[model samples]
Target chain A: MTSQLFSHDVQHTLDIAGIFVFALSGGLLAVRKNLDIFGIAMLAEATGLGGGVLRDLIIGAVPPAAFTDIGYFITPLAAAVVVFFLHPEVERINWTVQSLDALGLGLFAVTGTAKAHDYGLGAVASVALGVATAVGGGVIRDVLANEVPSLLRWDREIYAVPALAAAILVAVLIAAHALGPVTGTGAALVAFALRMLALRYGWR
Target chain B: MTSQLFSHDVQHTLDIAGIFVFALSGGLLAVRKNLDIFGIAMLAEATGLGGGVLRDLIIGAVPPAAFTDIGYFITPLAAAVVVFFLHPEVERINWTVQSLDALGLGLFAVTGTAKAHDYGLGAVASVALGVATAVGGGVIRDVLANEVPSLLRWDREIYAVPALAAAILVAVLIAAHALGPVTGTGAALVAFALRMLALRYGWR
Candidate 1:
């Protein structure tokens, strides 16, 4: 039971980190829009927690992580406050943020697929939820920023496709009972590299 | 069953009207942000359908209204397009837009309560969903506009409260087997009047 709890905590930590990166993206965009700190915080919270809350509620998890976990809620708030104070530095090192975002997307894609499967969803539905989890936050962030959702825009290169690949990897591993440490890390590495490559080469 | 379907259709029509008003509000706000047509359309869609889509998905409705009903998606697009072309008219009588917003809020509150009941949710949960439905679009709109969510702010008076009252009124009447022209219209009227008065006198 302690081992089980430890694993759950590890997964939750990854999810929280993913949400933080997503929130940072939203907060930075809010700054670009010349929003105040409060506005930045709101956008961060919306982009970071919105999709997970939606997914949890749909899956019959009540109260949502936004309401149940102060840690999750505070993570975005802290990220916003940091971005609030360090706008210039943030703007200068946006590349670092992008790298962290790619890492988050990969981890979150795996987490989402695994979570959906844990919720007893079939592999297909699990993969779909994984994609939703990975990209949903960004879609919402773009929509809130009053831009066409990058996910929906035809001009954007291979955004959702990388998330899909990650989800497929997890689904295949879980199906084969081969989601060992090496395989799990390999799957995440594949997703992270693919996303980074997509950003690098403008690959569609 | 025919009566039920008829009532559903009527509710759908009212929902369409609500979506129209909600879209108008979003479009106007996006204009204030100096966003382009695509940006305006994104805001309009977020404001018009975000709440209902959230409510439906929370209740395990798949694809969501904006995805399942082409009209729900198209309505906001059309409204945004109209606003893009007729900015002068929209600017001239913003008061009319506020009034329409009140009407939409009332309609959505009632419809959300009704739908929640149809799903056999408890009265409390139904009321929660109703409030969310009435305010969800605006929340999304404000988030996109980079403003603090009006519903969450104490400065906004009687937004969710009036919608809650309206939803409770409907739920009570339906429970009492006395839901008719009197209770239905009375609930909607009460909600609308409260919202209008809030708008006029600054009920916050």
Candidate 2:
């Protein structure tokens, strides 16, 4: 009885895709911090899986997808391997990384909200979880790297706002019983577009 | 049908006590960092409940005890209030603070292991979760304060070792069918004593 907006397979794909991109950011940060390979791999895994793990725990999803799904566990390692061998090339494409990160943020926000709602959480709580799913891993990465969480810092480009907006849109669409694939994708696109615009315009 | 080692009421009481002490430490740090009142309260709550919340989430406890239990929610705020007006005096009593923190470390280790075991996790995973329950809040507090986690910093006094030892002992006792109230209390005391001795001897 899965809703169209909650296309289970598509959501899984996006979740894994987002995790890979986030892991790349984490790996890049670990390299910049002069961490060894182990540290890099650990950061990659933590950054990629931390948010989803947190969200799963809060929703009472035991063992978490990170622990249960081999793909979820291995994707970060793959990202780490990629980063370790070609970090110099990876670092040169900061814009590309940011764009992918925005996409990750958007996908996580929409999917996370949908999943939370599926678990019978109220809309507001679902939206909050969605934002957490979008940004939680980066917070863990910063903590491990001894940096202040960008989510809490005012100097960073507006990150959580777009996620919050996208999550809320999904919640609204769900409440209105109109959360088909088109609107769901639209909600994610809104986050991506807003984030890209913020990056381009140097918003906050 | 609770086991002697898993006395539910006693566990809840210890959890609340540990949370309060942890919150005091968090509030003290916030005060030192010149955070405002709201920030102080937030830190207090986060520091007090963060570890337990993490444990609960991993073990499939929904909503978290922090959210479901009024006392769990309020104890940290009370600690924050105490810290707000009396931080100077509180800081002067660092020995007392360390002692309470050690006791918290011990209680959380023992109780966390028991809870995870009750949830059917294997002994090793239960022990790991126990240590996490003991130290996770401090890590969160330090991270939010923009300090490197004392857990990861070797320069700090030995911390995780005692918690780990306590948790392992509890797991072993459970496996041996000897984890009654007496042995459970003894396990907690081991962590407390180890931490105290470490502080006294400047174990790093």
The candidate that wins on DockQ is 2
Worst 10 residues of 2 chain A by lDDT: A1-10
Model 2 CA deviation exceeding 4 Å by range: A1-4, B1-45, B48-52, B58-60, B65-139, B146-204
Question: Which residue pairs overlap in candidate 1's backbone?
Answer: A144-B144
Give the alpha carbon lDDT tens digit for every residue of B19-76 in model 1.
9999998998899899999999999999999999978876666667778888898999
What is the per-residue lDDT of model 1 for residues A29-130, given as tens digits with 9 covering 90 to 100?
888877667668767887888778766765566545554455776789888998999988988898888888888888777777777777788999988998
lDDT of candidate model 2 versus the reference = 0.88
Model 2 / residue A57 / CA error / Å? 2.4
Best by TM-score: 2
The C-alpha lDDT values of all candidates are 0.79, 0.88
| TM-scores for the candidates | 0.58, 0.63
True contacts kept of each: 0.06, 0.33
RMSD of 2: 6.2
If candidate 1 were superposed on the true structure by all CA atoms, what would the RMSD be?
A: 8.3
TM-score of chain A of each: 0.92, 0.97
